[model samples]
Target: MSREKGKEFAEQDLTPMTGAATDVAPLGRQQKPAHELTADEDIDVADWDRVAAMAEFKQLVLAKRKFILPATIFFVVYYFALPALVGYAPGLMSKRVFGVVNVAYLFALSQFFMAWLIAALYVRAANRFDGMAQRIISKLKGGR
Candidate 1:
């Protein structure tokens, strides 16, 4: 509305416009103050560096690299190959597949399916990674 009305509304709003409301807890649950919450936690802030250096963490990194690197390489190659084929091997790519759909067009369309397939595969692999990460964190926390 008017600038004065806007200013009045802004003044009436109790919530801060920026940054998270640290005082509020979920579902109307009463939370301890920030300092108290940090003090009561079992994790030591100093040990975070040590946790990152742990063998379990290294294994997690290696596992992710193993899956992600190959998937990335594969997708990059497949995605580029379509255009490369169209440019370099135009005759081959121009060959009709269905009625008017050429090999190049089919290959380009298959990229969408390839992307979805890669995403699905990554999600499956990431679930395993999540389990590994949780185990590593649990070990670091001196739990199960």
Candidate 2:
């Protein structure tokens, strides 16, 4: 093909396809640079000022608070409820299904597993919460 034809073809190929547009995050969506924060380190005020000005940053802060409250409530309820149920309702819950292992016995034993599972879940969730909190704080404080 002629150079002119090639150029025209390239231009045509570059045209946006109907309903096929890909989502592209702007450059700002990328991760912020790392910073070593210490108790005595001086903070950069400009970054915080910029972040505080953003609506998305405010939403993130609010969302974190929203999740934390419910997570705390759930943790309290499940933590207390499981133990209490196991202790008080053992007879009611008792049922032999696997040899001599009763439902109550299983429920009591399962609490240990439940504790570990809850801990693991909380650790993962809290880590994410910590990240958002730190990000919001850093943005407010002007840290990278």
Candidate 3:
């Protein structure tokens, strides 16, 4: 298309399908300019530093580390155990279960379930972590 036509298209008012004039901003909702955005207005660095240094924060971090490190180690071991077993003992892995279905296939399939269970557990733990974090924020804000 021509530059003028393109410019016209760009400048065209996008009316709703109902053909009624709406209060919505043209082209879409108006957004605040980056410089005008005050997303960090309530965040005090000193308060954040103080909260980070608190024993509560340290406990929170340690708690997360304790859970996550062990969980990660467990998952890694569990995930790799299948391959190691298959490689080391192909005869055992090849053994039939119900008709043609083998042990290896069942074990591989179980990995999917294991991953989903881990994710669910992580979500539950994360909810607790969120509560801890909120408490820390509240303490910093002098609300607790």
lDDT-sorted candidate list, best first: 1, 3, 2
For residues 56-75, write the lDDT of model 3, one tens digit per residue: 89989998998899889989
Lowest lDDT sum, 10 consecutive residues, model 3, at 1-10
* Ranking of candidates on TM-score, top first: 1, 3, 2
| Residue-by-residue lDDT tens digits, candidate 2, 1-144 | 122332333333222333324334326545222232243553332334455667767776677677667777876786687668768877666778699887777766766887687678767776877777667654434422
Q: Would you list the C-alpha lDDT of every candidate in the order shown?
A: 0.72, 0.58, 0.72
- What residue runs in model 2 are displaced by over 4 Å at the alpha carbon? 1-61, 79-91
What TM-score would every model get versus the actual structure? 0.67, 0.44, 0.65
Backbone clash total, candidate 2: 2
Top-scoring candidate (lDDT): 1
* Inter-residue clash pairs, candidate 2: 48-140, 48-142
RMSD of each: 15.1, 17.0, 14.8
The numbered model that scores best in TM-score is: 1
